[model samples]
Structures are given as structure tokens and as C-alpha cells.
Target: MDNRFNFSVPDICDDHADKVQVSNLRLQSFGGNDTFSGPIETINCPDDNSLVKEILNTPGKNRVLVIDAKGVSHASMVGDQIAAKAESNNWNGIVVNGYVRDTEVLKTIPLGIYAIGSIPKKTDKHGLGSIGNDVFVGGILIQSGNWLYIDSNGWVIAKNELKF
Candidate 1:
């Protein structure tokens, strides 16, 4: 799918603040692409990236994967390998409520990655997590199928896809 909405977060907020919910957290960008938007696919996992790997292996159709890592900072939730898969799978972006590793490689991929920070340690592949569920990140309730707009400014969630 082509990128229809290329506007920034502040611009969207200025026009449709009443129709959008902005995430409170100031997530850091680590991907080659800094701006991306798409339908949300939520995952709730804690210190385990088994589900993350599972989803990235499937087709993305330009959708964004929102991983709720329960705010774990001890270990990385995503790294270069997984992110490369996401890019190859046609995923537009990935938003992690936790840390990610391989920052150098992540900066080279075409995917847009937003996370709290970076860590060298990897996550445990316990295959523990739930998919297609509502996840809370930065105090914003991000539900599956919701439209997510992310840029260098921040992220905004809308009930429906918005065109600028």
C-alpha cells in the first residue's frame, strides 16, 4: 500500500485533535525511515520476543506492529534480525514500549522503529504473549485495526484512517 498520509503529528493534531489520541511517551526513532503510518496490530509481551518474531515473519501489507513489552528496560525486545524481517515483510513500522538492540543495523533498515531506548542484551524466546489485543503505551490505548500515525514528533492514534 502506498503512503497516503505523509503529514506530521503536530499537523494532524492541529486539524484533528478531537479525533485522535496522542501517546504521552517520547519514543526514540532508530530506523531508516522516521515517518510512517498504517493500521495497528498490537502485541502484549513481556521480556519475550517469540510473538514478535512470529508476526514479523507473516505478511504486513504496510501495517504497523505495536509491541507492548510491559516497559521492560533490562533486555531488548527487538534487534536487527527481527527488524530486517519486518522490512522484508513489507511492514511500514514497529512501535515498541520497551528497549531494542542493534541500533546501528536498525538505522539502516527501511522500516520505521520507535522504542523507549536501546540495550545490548536480547530477549528470551519463551513464546509467551497475546496478539491482536488492545495495548497501552504512553497511557494511550492502542487497539488493533486503529490507524496509527508516527513521525519524528511522536505518535497519534485515530479510530479511522485520516487523509491529509
Candidate 2:
């Protein structure tokens, strides 16, 4: 899809032309907030076992899944396995403000996952988390029912559906 009309947080914040800066070989793209305007479904989990199943069942045909991992450093919140599930389910993408595992594998999938870093350890399955709620990360308000736009440049959120 042509991203020229798409709004990128990084470029907008920099007062530069709307241009998406593609990353290098799955490298960090400087992590920017994507503007989103739609229904918000928050998934707060440390492991993919529970979240993965829920993600697979999610009806995100054209919506985004914002996951709040509580910025946990113990383990990864999302990974390639869950990403694959999301892709197969036709989800727009996943935004994890926490850590993710299996970068190499995740890159292979078309899931748009934004996270802090990668971890080698997986999360423990305890079936603990909240779905369909508001979540805040990096002091950014990610309320339910908001539109989130993401790209190679960065991410941004809009209170309502925006036109570029």
C-alpha cells in the first residue's frame, strides 16, 4: 500500500515531510507512536500462551491489538509464534510496549509489532491479564476506541479517524 498519505509520528514530530523510514534487516526503527482511532483492545500478559489464543480468536480483521505487558523485564510479551497466529487470523498488527522474543522469526511474519526490546526467556503461563481496556505506555494515552497508525517511520494515535 502507498504510505505517502499515511501519517507517521516520527516525521510529524520532526516537522519533516511525511516519509516512512524503513528499518534495516529488522533493526530498530527508533520506535515511534502510531496514531490510531478505533476500538481499543488491551492485552496485558507476559506470555503468549494465553494471549496467543486470545489473539488468534480476535476479530481484528482491520483493527489493531494494543498489548500492555506492564513493561515486564522478566520475559518477552510477544514473539514470532504469536505473531504468526495474528497474521494467519488477518489481524492488522500488534503493538507491544514491552519486550518481544524471536526477532528473527517475527521479521518473517507480516505482523506490525512495536516493542522495547527482545528477550531470550519466555513468559510463564499463568493466564493473567485484562482484555478490552485502556492502557498507557511511555506516558502516551492509548484509550479504547482510538485509531492507531503504524509504518516503517513510526506510530501515532488519533482520537478519530483521520485523513492522512
Candidate 3:
């Protein structure tokens, strides 16, 4: 009945490669936690962070929020305040498919934050984008409720929590 994932990404690849889907994007670590794992929550928000903000307001329940920002380089879907809110709400991790702002502050947060890069441009809050949707990025198809595991090596997703 234990759901804790203490296994490393490399070990998972070596032992359970066929059972997990790995992300091709080389996401930079921006949070205090280098290793984290939990069920996935998806957001397809590009150029706007309304959905991101909205979701972060709710209880995370130890879930990881996967955001598909369309790899937008100009606008950041996450920032210091948003990330802090997520941490305060108990989100296990956040994997951004786009850029983020406040790099230094993001690193202090106690969670896993993997993003393509950083930018100073903040996104608009148009309340646009869909939640609980499939996010395709870096040759991986991420859906809500999928389990995501991140370690110092990299990230890997599975349909359910892996027990090792």
C-alpha cells in the first residue's frame, strides 16, 4: 500500500524502461527538491497563466502539475508567486513545457520544478487554456492522472505509480 517512489530515474530505466515514458526535453531544475514523484495534472496553457493560477489555488493532494505552454519563449507561464502558491498548497512538483520567471526565487521553493528555460516576460492572465487535458511534449504524451517520477537524472512518466 505504500505509494512513495524512492527509486531513481536511471534505475527505473534499467529495470522498468518498457513500463514508463521518458521526456526528451532537458528541463533545468529550479526548485529545492531534486527528486519528486506523484500523479500528474495537465494544463495546456500557452501565453496565459490563468489556468495555472487557478489550479494552484486548489489543494494539490501531492499531484504534479504538467503544463504544456507550447514552448513559448516570450511569455512565462510560471513565476515566483505562482510557484510559491503551489508549494504552499502541497503540490509535489511542477513540470513546465515552456519558460518561467524569477529563477533565483524558484530555486528556493521546496518542490520539483523542471522547465525548458527561464525568461523575464510574464504571461497574461486571460483565463485561457484547458485543464485536465493531455499534454504532448518532447515525444511524450502526458495525461492527467498519470504518474510522474523525477530524479536528479531526469523525468519519467507512467500510467500508474510504480512500486519498486
Q: Which lDDT values do the candidates have, in the order given?
A: 0.92, 0.60, 0.89
- Candidate closest to the true structure, highest TM-score: 1
Angstrom error of the Cα, residue 62, model 3: value is: 0.3
The Cα RMSD in angstroms, rounded to one decimal, for candidate 2 relative to the true structure is 5.9
Pick the winner on lDDT between candidates 1 and 2. Answer: 1
List runs of model 3 lying over 4 Å from the truth. 1-5
- The best-first sequence of candidates by TM-score reads 1, 3, 2
Error of 3 at 86 (Å): 0.5
Q: How accurate is candidate 1 locally (lDDT)?
A: 0.92
Q: Is candidate 1 or candidate 3 better by lDDT?
A: 1
Record all residue pairs in model 1 with backbone atoms less than 3 Å apart, i.e. clashing.
none
TM-score of predicted model 3? 0.95
Clashes of each: 0, 21, 0
lDDT at position 68, candidate 3:
96
What C-alpha lDDT, on a 0 to 100 scale, does residue 146 get in candidate 1?
Answer: 95
The full ranking of all candidates by lDDT, starting with the best, is 1, 3, 2
Question: Compared with the true structure, what per-residue lDDT tens digits does model 3 show for residues 14-41?
Answer: 8888899888888888887878899999
Report per-prediction Cα RMSD to one decimal.
1.3, 5.9, 1.6
